[model samples]
Structure formats: structure tokens, C-alpha cells
Target: MTVTATLAGLDPTTLGDALRVAGSPGFDRWQDQIRRTGGCSDPIHLTGTTVTRDRDTGQVLHSYSTEAEPGGRLRVACGNRRASRCPSCAWTYAGDTYHLIRAGLTGDPAKGTPHTVRNHPRVFATLTAPSFGPVHNRPGRGHRPCRCGIHHPADAPELGTALDPAAYDYAGAVLWNNHAGHLWRYVTIYLPRELAKCAGITQRELRERLRISYGKVAEYQKRGAIHFHAVIRLDGPDGPDTAPPAWATRDLLTNALRTAAARAEVALPAVGDQPARVLRWGTQLDVQAIGAFGHGEDLTEQAVASYVAKYATKAAEATGTVDRRIGELSELDKLPDLPDHTRRLIRACRDLDALYPDRKLWQWAHMLGFRGHFSTKSRRYSTTLGALRQVRADYRAAQQRAALGLPDPDDHPEATTLTLAHWAYAGHGHTPGESWLAATIARDIQHNRDTAREHRAALDTAGEW
Candidate 1:
């Protein structure tokens, strides 16, 4: 039997509903709504009315109602950063992340960052979790057989699985993730102190002479441990626009990071009869100097930005864990589909939740106990995600204004406009037919973007515009 026929046979009700929607007279309008959402897999349905009034004249300039929209509701992308949930939204999020990181490195005047930031002493650093146990891994240097006597491929599923699962410290692993943020906080605190020691100055003196600005993103390793990829910059006390002191070189920053990572430790409170465990960064710290936009042998600003952005959309799923919450202990038994390692981690999280009620381990079990933001930046690092999103909103508003032939809001400062909007959540998700069509549209958009990028790259290589 054909796939469609088989699917229809397996779920007739859903198939029939999808078919009916496809044949409906409003299908084109429905497709338009879906396209406006960038083909989000689960677009949020909102029923609302919006009235735009000129405050000066007390006249209704414009009004909109979802009553005329498809299904009497407006749909918007869920805006989930997880690609697994919504690829369309995830793509948008990754693009925003890339720009945010790139702006900090190369600078964008529009984003309030100066081009002089490119000359700041910057390094791309990777901070990792201390090993809880030995896991199957491909030893660096040359491809060698694992301790398990197996020569694992690059994509091997067994790569991160413990050689002896029974002996693995699952509790330690989960707790490490829970405390990772705290550990990073300690590192940040100690970093300046280390820098001062290196410069033969006091912490107060270091602060007066130089400042540290950083942007970091957390990534889950195959072993389900959380690690950090960061762009660390040493700027003058005034921030990125000002030049760093002569003593603030890339080597000094790298050494300070190494010392801080080594010294930074967080000791957990002793629970029950268990002794307090001290958490610190793993021995495998990699600090690489970041080069200027188009020079030097080290990592380029664009490469570092792209690399950090790539991890911003990911979670524990990269390590075989599920991308959702575990509501109950019975849920563990039903998750036979999960890998043995992942299942054990979930079980450990659930089990530990009772012992450490304050930790709320079960709440973040899906994340393997991590609760930190995927991407974070210091205040002076660069523009914010909110600022980037505002830029997009402003552009869209401008387009709408031009299309409607409305006077520029900025041009009329004396007149104010009041917007009243009320929206109620209706529902989400699409009919199977809608899903199929939306997916096709998303693919086409991505393809066009990729093609345009390729063309641009080709033109650049050929030294043409």
C-alpha cells in the first residue's frame, strides 16, 4: 500500500480532517497565515482586536480584528529556540544569535558597538565539566580503539556511554549540571583576581585599568555534561570602545582564564550522610586567541560567533536525552524508547528530586539537570537579543506603514498614537495537510537563502560585487 493510504488507514479521523481542510475554500488564506508564521510546526492561534487611535484628535486611525482572518484567529510562530520543536523559529533564533555575537566581535554601529572592539584582546575559550566517570571516546592524536576494545566511528552512538554503566556516577553528573551556573559565577568572580595577580596589581587597580566583557553559550556534550563556549574580551575600564592597557594582551587573558578555571570551585552542601562535593572545570580547557575579522592564524571573529550560535539552539538532546519534561516516575518506565544512558540519567534525576527537594531536579530532568540560559552576555558585551528583535519589529512596522501610506510616526512628534490590543489564546498546531504545505514553504525559503548566500560567496571569491 502507498504511504498516504497507509497513513489514512492508521488514522482515518486525522486524515479526513486534513483532507477536508485541504479542499476548503479558505485553504489559500490558511496557507497565507501559515507562511506569515514562517511555517512554524505549531503556530499559536490568537483571537484579538487591535485599534489604533490618534491621541491628539481622538480619532480611530485604524482598526483590525481577527474575525476576518482564517478560522477567526491569527497565527504566529511559537518562537521556540529548539530546532526539534520548530525549525523555522529555530532558524530565526540562530540568525539573531549569530548577529548578536558577530556584533560584539566585529562591531556594528547600529547595534551600539564600535568597530574598535575588533582590536580588543579577545579569546575563544571552552570550559568543560569534570568527568564523573570514564566513557567510550575516540582518543585524540590518532584514531585508536576505545578502552572497550572497540574502534568507534565518528558518529558512534556508544561514544559517550559509560564503559561500565553500573559504576558511573549518574548522581554526580546531574548535580554537576545543576551547579554549573554557580561554578561559572565563581569563575567569573575569580577571573579578575587572577588577572590582577598576573599584572602585579590589586583587584581594585585591575578594575580601574581594565574591564572584562564576555559572551558565552552552553553546549551539551555527548556524555550529557554541559560545557561552555565563550568569547572573552579584555577592554579598557570605559568598555569596548576604549583601548585596553598595554599589559592586557591575549596571552595575559589566556593565562588568567587558566588560573581562574583551576582556582574556581563551588562546594555543594552536604546532604543527609553524603559529604559535600567540590565542583570545578575539567582538565581539558582550551583557550584560543581570536584574530581580527580577516587576519591572523587564530580563530576568526565570524567563526567564533557562528560556532557559539550553533550551540545556542541545542540542548541535552545532542547527548541522546529527550527534549521535554518528565512529569512522573512512571514516565521513566514508559520511556523504553530512550537510550540506556539517557534513561538512566532521567531515572537518576527523578530519584534525586525527592532527596533534594530544594534543587527541583525533576523540573529540569529533560535538560539532564541544567537550568542555565543557553546564551548569556555581560552588559557591555554587545547588543541584546531583545534589541535585535526590536530592529526586526521596527522594519516590519515600516513596511506596513509604507504599504498603508501612513505618515511616519517619527515624523510627527507632536501627535501621539495609542494602540489598544486584546488577544486570547485559542489553540495551536495545524492539520496534517497544512503541516505538509507549511513544511514545503519553509524548505523553499531556506533553499532560497542558501542559494543567495552561495551566490554572494562566489561573487566575493571572484572579486565582484
Candidate 2:
């Protein structure tokens, strides 16, 4: 079979190389490696050797070397959760995020959460950054002309652009992003205080009666500002498994959130000639009560989980900014593809770096001055991403042991083993032929997963599980 003829629309040069790779003797092994990665677009290459030994008997149990593998190196997924960087990894990340958020709300025995958590008071809250300057926006409620004298569409490129870039508070915009994490921290601290006050009890008494659990993700707005979407829940002192006091209701949680948000403020010290600035959340606060399971509402458990997970893998790219670190000032000039608004934000970050070196504005200029993790959760909210990844690793190890006819790790009461490994980073990414093949495999795998999910949903609708 002529592989080149089968693959239409590919350039002749790329087709020839792909055909040669397809006919190579190591093609099967190479394909297996790519499949193992779920067809990651940019996999990391490593040169290494690993030896497993029985610690008690001082016997070599297993030995492996990348030199023996195809291309004389091992390839591993980069595991970046950014969708633009690697879709394969991003999909996995979104799935894990969905599971983590869902487990907290709906409970999952496998994840060590109780089903009774569904009874906890929960709300979906959105905290936004205060305006640094007026920008074009589509006002909700009755279509009206924007301040720019034009009714901008939801997808308009000019929607978030400043009406007057020169007069806009660019420094304040960047600084707000830098301090967003601190603001959120203060909000969390004040939340319990407000709840206690509402209950006419002290902080210590409130803690003894109830606890606050939350999972939040930061998202970039089109104007290059960061906002947060969080699922906030009220649990008993011991956590989700225990029922909250009768006084804790969704209305109480909403009132407490509003009070905390209004009271939470971060004061920034004067930088250079700039005066001390006080930053707080925008007035457009949204706090909605999440309905119980099977209830029809926008704030249902599944809808909230899906919404948070959808943004977990996104970043400044959604706001016309690059999703990478900016190293030098001159680098920005070389890229004409960036929008003017994004360029101005990046320039502001760079210009302020000298004045506020401690903030590391230049280092995170690509992110528009935000350096915090996109997704974060309070301890005891649910299982963690690290724990989920460890579970996957353990499952894979068990599969490998079974394939090799070895005893299960749990079967041996007093057995112990030591693993000796040394690895060096060789490089990253793939050759042109490899890149095409890996992308195809990734698409197919994602398609299959989607199909399976749809089929399961259909079965669930028909009461088939």
C-alpha cells in the first residue's frame, strides 16, 4: 500500500517523510509510545535508565533503559494543563477538574467524600476586578449604546478595548491582577468572621459549629483583568461528611459572602511616585444559590462543576494575549500578531518591572501580570489533583506488574523494593512526521472518549446507567 496516496492534502515533502516513518521497522514501537501519551502534541524527550531491586534479598528485579527503546530515548507527556499548549493534556486536566469538583458537591466514595454533602449549603459566586478605566461593554438588560456611542456585539474585537488607552490606568490594571490572590485570601479570612457575626457568635464558636469549603478558578476577562468563579459550601466542623447546623442555609451563605466581599480590601503601598492604592472587588458581584441534585437551575451541581472545569484549562489566550512568558521587551516588537490592547498590557507590565521589581511583573508579563495558579481549592474541599495523579500512577504500576507476572504490592506483607533511576532531559517536541501522526491519534482518542460519554448519557437518560 502506498501511504502517501492514502494521506491526501499533505505536502509532498511531509508525505514522503511520513511514508518513510510508516515503513520503518520501529514504527510500531514509536506508535505505542505516542499512544501511551494519549498523543500529546509536545512530548518531552529523556535519556535515562532505571533498575528495580529487591531490597531485602539484594537481587535485581527489573532493569530498563531508554537506549533500548525506539529513537534511543523515552518520550513523556509535558502534562501542561493549558489547552493551547497541549490539547491532549488539557482534556485530561479538565476531566480531573470535573471529577474533583463533582466529588465535592455530589460525593464519591472512591474519592473519600460522602454522598450527604449534597445537603450542604452551596452557592456559585463570581468576584470581579474593579474597573481601572472605562472600556466598551455590552450592558446586560435592554440593549443600549455603549459609552463609545456604538452597540458592540458580544464577539466584537473592540468590546474590551479602552476608550482612551492613554488615559486608562494600565498600572492599576496590572497591579490588581498581581494582588488578586491576596484579595481572595482576605475574603476567605473575613468570610468566617461575617458568618459568625450573622449567627451572633464568636469566630471560635462559629468554627466549632461549622466550616467553609470552597473550590475556585481564576479566569482572565477580555480587558486583561482576572476574575474568580467559585463554588462555596457550608459544612459542619468536621467537613462534608457532617451535617451543618440548622441555622446554616443558602440565604445565610449568600448574605455572608456579600458582607465578606464588601468588607474584603487590600491596600497597596506607594510605588515610585504613585500613591498608596486601595483595591477591592467590582460592584457587579453575582452570588447564586446552587440547587440540590436533580433540581433544574443554572446553579445546579453539574452545571457549576462543568463551568469551573471549562475555564481551568484556559488563560489569557481567551483575552487576545499569548499564553507564554515574555522574557525581553524587544521580543514584543517582533510579534505584530498581538492585539493593541494586549500589547499595551504587556508593555505596562514591562515598564512597571523596574519600579516594582519585587512583584516580578516582567517575568509574568505574558499572563498580563497574574502569576497565581488558575485553579485553587481550600484544604478538605475534596481530593486533590496530586492525589488523583498518584492513583493513576499506582493503577498503571499494577497493570505493569500483572503483565510481568509479578506479585501485587499488597500481596507481599514484608516485601520491599528500591528503584534506582537517573534521567537527563534531551529535548522537547516532535519531528514533522511524528507531529502529524500524534495529532491524528489524539483526535481519534478524544473522539472515542466523547462518543463513549454520549452513549453513557443516552443510557442514563433511559434509566440504564
Candidate 3:
């Protein structure tokens, strides 16, 4: 009666009646969710029927009739969060990604890695895009002169600003960003080889005694360039959770990085079948020793972990991959600060999108036709995003069950089984109201993380106490 009354044309009088009957508990639950998290900018409202079967016997013994659920439909979250695309969902995803990256770095996969693997020499290394013709820069790494006489200011927005916009190689950068995954895949193969060469062992033999375990995140530079920041560690074949070989010092790892960055290269099909494009990492490569806290000037392990985690949730959209599709050359015009090279790459992505519609590239059309996962890791590189997420879910479920005071929570079976759900997108984004709630929640979350960082820092400084 209460639920039905609330649905009576959504009038204030009826709403008051429903609230009085249903009480404040249920209302608070709904309101809290509305304020804290959103599924997407505009979530896909769904209407559907679902049934779970006994995999063993293929028998359906229960069902939740739509008559029983909210308007015979469920309010499900749309899972996208790009403010430009799906702000609501993007927020959720970004946070999840940060946790995932942090979990790997801290060896706290899921419930957490109480294990000792957290202390490895895990450094966050960044590899950047090279000169695709002169761009306005601060003039030098050490303050050398550019071909132009102007010495760019330290805060100059023009740094990486193209001197000759017409001559800018946007195409090259776009293709490079697209192929970066492959380039990374190549790095996975070559960096180890470089390490092996340094150790005076064949790649295979080197593997028998030592292993390079790493987790990496890719980020987009303000200049529309893609750079990779990774947590690299050399462990005995067993990897983190185990001590590395004595030979696997940070110095040796750094040296191997230098050799690998210079030697790694791959070739992609040339534009318009003209020729082949040789691909490799950018000239700017950085490696730092990540070890015990405060031992060096490099990024700390925990800080690096948090950094990688931060980018885990970003999409090409964050760096501005709108439209996810391009109909013609003019579409590129709508984009700002995009180099001609990048524009050409966007055009190429559109072209390739047709060649492989199976890839659902148009869905990522804003990414300029690349469909590869933006961030990935080697199979053996600690816990995975999936595993970490599952653990968190399990923990959360346990907490909920505990709150309910349910006995043997994991084994509890729903006595009744029947559900019908239907929901249509009212649309996404904060309706000023929801937006205020989300922002407030986001601020709270940020503070909580800052607190955690400080706590961890205190613990590190106090060590073994």
C-alpha cells in the first residue's frame, strides 16, 4: 500500500503518505545512493527478464515477478563516467582503477597484500613522445637554445607548442598513441632481452634465475601525447613476494632501461599504403629507484602505486576522445589544439573503423580507431584488476551481511525468488542536486585518501615500531 501510494502520479500529498508508511530508512538509502555515485553521464535505462539456472541440472526453481519490484523495474547504474561522455560512470571507474593500481603496488590485491612484496624496488618510470618537428619548449632539458632564439618560460604554455602548426606531425602522434600498446608489448619482449644482455646471459637463461615483474599505467600528456608510467621490479623467477637476485640491483635495471629504450622498435603499415612506419618508444625515457622510503630522490613505492592507480580509470575521453566516431574531415575541425598529424590519425582511425566494424571501433571512435585496452599488464605481474575488484566486492558483501546479522552469510540463499525489472534513462549527470551530492562525496573521498596517505607515511617513517 505504501509503495503503491508513492507511485500515485508522484504528487506531494501521496509522497508524504508513502514516506510516512515506508519510514525514513528506505528513503535514506535511495537518497544516499543518488548523492554518492552515478553510473554514467546518461545511464542506459534497462527493461529485462532474467533467470538463474542450476548449472548442474538446468532447472529454474524461483523467479521474482516484476509485480514485486519497484514499478516492476530496477534502477541500475549506467557504467560510464567521462564528464564529456558519461560523467557519472567515469567517476566510479576512475576510483576503481586507482584502487586497482594501488592494490598491485602495495601487494594489497583485494582485501590487501599483507605480504612483504610491498618493499621491492618498484619505480614509476615514464616514457614520453619524441620531437615530431620543433614545438615551443623551455628551450632545453638543461636550458639549451631552440632553433628559435626565444627561451620559453618555465611555465610557458607554448612548451610542446608547435612552432609551425601546419608542419606539426599530429598524424604521427596519433598513430603512435594508437600503436603504443603494441609498442609496450614489444617493450615487454625487449626490456627483458636488454636485461638479459646486461647480465651476460641468454634471454632464456636469464629468465631461469631472474624475472622482471612490473605493473604499468599509461597517461595522456596535456600536449595530446601519450606517455607510459610503470612500476617495474626485477624479482627472482618467482617475482614479487620473493627476493630478487643479487644481480638485479636498481642500477642494473636502470642501465637495462637505457639500452632497451634505444633498441626497441616496431613497424606499422604506412598511411594510404605508401610505405611502412617505423615505431619505437620516444627518446625521453626515465627510470628511478623505488625502494625503502626516503632512501633516494625517486618516487616512493606507495606514491608511485597511487600515481599509477590514478590513471587506471582514465579513458581516451579524459584526454578528449569525443564523438567516438568521425563522419568526415570537418569533424576534426571541432577539436582544439589538435595537431595536423593527430587530425590525420583521427581520419585514419575513421578509415580503419570501417575495415573492422567487428572491433566496435566506432564505439571508441573518439580514440581514433584504436580498440586496445588503454592499460594492461603481464600475466604474472601481481594481482589483476578483476581479482582485486572481486575481493573488494566479497569484502563489501561480507560487511553488508554482517550488518544484517545474518548467520552463515556466505551460504544464505534467498528464500523467495522472483524479480522483474524495467528502467528507462531519465538521463545522466547531476541535476544540480545530484551533482552537488557527488561533488560533496568526491571531496569526502579525496580527504579520506589523503588521510590514508599520511597514515601510511607515518607508518613508513616509524618502520617496525
For every model in order, what is the number of clashing pairs?
0, 0, 27
Q: Give the clash total for candidate 1.
A: 0
How many residue pairs in model 3 have overlapping backbones?
Answer: 27
Q: Evaluate model 1: give its TM-score.
A: 0.94
Q: Provide the lDDT at 199 for model 2.
A: 90
Residue range 1-465, candidate 2, lDDT tens digits? 123454677887777767777888888888888888998999999999988888888788888899877778899989999999999999889989999999889988788679988888988999999998998888762198889788887788887889999899998999899889988999999999999999999999999999999999999998999999999989999988788999998898999899999998888788887779998999989999887657666568888899999999998996678778877778878888888888999998988898888989989999999989999998988999998999989999999878866567699857788889999999999877778878888988888899999999999999999
| TM-score of each model, in listed order | 0.94, 0.95, 0.71
Identify the candidate with maximal lDDT: 2
Per-residue accuracy of model 1 over 1-465 as CA lDDT, tens digit each: 011443345266666766776677777888778777888988999999988888878788888999988789899989999988899998899999999999989989888689999988999999999998999998872278888888888888887889999999998899999989988888899999999999999999998999999999999998999999999998899988788899899999999999999988878778875568888889999999888755766688889989988888887877777778778767767766677887888778887887789889999999999988999999998899999989998998889877866667798777688889999999998876667667767877789889999999899889895
User: Which is the better candidate, 2 or 3, if ranked by TM-score?
Assistant: 2
The global C-alpha lDDT for each of the candidates, from Candidate 1 onward, is 0.86, 0.88, 0.59
What's the TM for model 3? 0.71
- Record all residue pairs in model 2 with backbone atoms less than 3 Å apart, i.e. clashing: none
Model 3 weakest lDDT span, ten residues long: 36-45
Better of 1 and 3 by TM-score: 1
Residue 460, candidate 3: alpha-carbon lDDT: 74
